[model samples]
Target: MAVLLHLDSSLFPLENSGSRQLTDAFRRTWQEAHPQGSVIYRDLAADRVPHLDAATVAADTLPPLRRQLIAEFEKADVVLIGAPMYNFTVPSTLKAWLDQIILAGRTFGEGVPASGKRVVVASSRGGSYRPGTPRAGFEFDTNYLEKVLGDALGLRVEVITRELTLAPVTPAMAALIPQAEESARQSLLRAAESAREHAALVS
Candidate 1:
């Protein structure tokens, strides 16, 4: 049966997390298109995956949580990840989940199918960090994930980003509120479209 696997790493509660909210929008539409399909949900912030240690060296000997994560990825036709930019990079919790899934002998290796799965990355940024901006070079979340998911693992990856999340609350960014609202609307539109398009792959 077709399955959707989702990971949410936002530190804030789901009601207040932009990344989570975007992912939810995608999931809702996706489910409407495939109501009979199964769904797997993992909340990394509430139940963080442990960092790699001696016990995590081999795929066959992975801990229960790590093994479960990999198994879910293996069965998933669609994977949704909530990646809120933290410290200019992916949240450490999300990174930990990636480390567990990117096993050389399992998820990746010579002669393996180059990812039959579709991956959606819902990215949320607190500030405006696009190209040509003063801090453009510091934007790392989407770039890093694209390389790892698209280049490294060969999954079909689509990234939809919501920026300037702090504009309404940060005194310094109050001037950007209008732009932030537009960005949010555009991001939601793109995410919904993407979900509708890719929902066919698993439906």
Candidate 2:
């Protein structure tokens, strides 16, 4: 049975945000596909992870907490992250969580062969940032996530972004909300399906 780590960092719950709603839908679909698989869900909003300070950073090189966090990461075959873009970047809580899991010589060895894991990030944004759009240059969240997970940690990273540009109440905005929501739902389903397929392949 595959172990999946599901991390939710949205400040808002499913009732108010597209990110949480899509993540829930994806989880249901994934569960249906893999009935025997186990999922460990972590809500950063309800239980916050402490930010790494100077002391923590200094001790990170030889800390038991680092080992504990790495053990959790190694236990999971798949990692699913539901991240909401805040001010064009990841939430602080998610950043803190990342800091905890990304350890040198554990998650990745700096000078040795790269042997990291895989991660899928499902992100929600209030505006469109796809390439060729004016807002595309402002997409620091997805870019930062990919870079951090792939370059720094040596993890294979895949990203799916659900932009809610059309959710506003104005006439023009109201016309696009349904379309945006549908797009988001489809993206979530596709990502979950891909993860299931990848899990089967690896197994």
Candidate 3:
């Protein structure tokens, strides 16, 4: 049976969270494609994972939570993450989850167990961060994920981004609401398409 590990780190609910919306689209499509498949979900913001501490780092054996997280990650055919940009990066909750699963010899370094796994990231940002944009340099969320999850962990990373997410709520960005809506629409489409493709590939 195929498995999908879904993680949502949005502080807001599905209706209010752009990242959650995208990830929900992906998950729904994936489930439709694979009715018998399994989905392991984690609402990171609500049930936050503990941050890496000295005891965990210094422990000779992997902690129970770390082991469980790693097992789930390794078992998944596709990993979907809802990573809303908080201060230009992923939420601390998501980071904590990553820290737990990323073991040097196991998931990170040479002969990585998670190598070639597909990871889809639903990224939502308040402002535009495309190349040549004013705030392009501040686009750390996706870049950092690509670096850590793709380059380092050797996962096949796919990102679906909804930019200018604040336009609908922030008075200052009112003019870009249309663009933001369009971005969100396109991102949702991409999420569904990506999920379908992965479902087929996994099958």
Clashes of each: 0, 0, 0
Alpha-carbon RMSD of each model: 1.4, 2.4, 1.1
Cα displacement (Å) at residue 78, model 3: 0.5
Cα error, residue 171 of model 1, in Å, equals: 1.4
Across 40-159, the per-residue lDDT of candidate 3 in tens digits comes to: 999999999999999999999998998899999999989999999999899999999999998898888876565689999999998999999988998889999999999889999999
TM-scores of all candidate predictions against the true structure: 0.95, 0.86, 0.97
At residue 133, what lDDT does model 3 achieve?
Answer: 95
| CA lDDT for candidate 3 | 0.93
Error of 3 at 94 (Å): 0.7
Error of 3 at 117 (Å): 0.5
Stretches > 4 Å off in candidate 2: 60-65, 165-172
By TM-score, the better pick of 2 and 3 is 3
Better of 1 and 2 by TM-score: 1
Q: Show where candidate 1 strays beyond 4 Å.
A: 58-60
How displaced is residue 46 in candidate 2, in Å? 1.1
Model number with the top TM-score: 3
lDDT of 1 by residue, 1-203 (tens): 77889899999986788999899999898888788888899999999988887756844567787778899999999999999999999999999889888988678877677975789999999997888898899989999999999888889999999999999899999999999999999998988888888778766
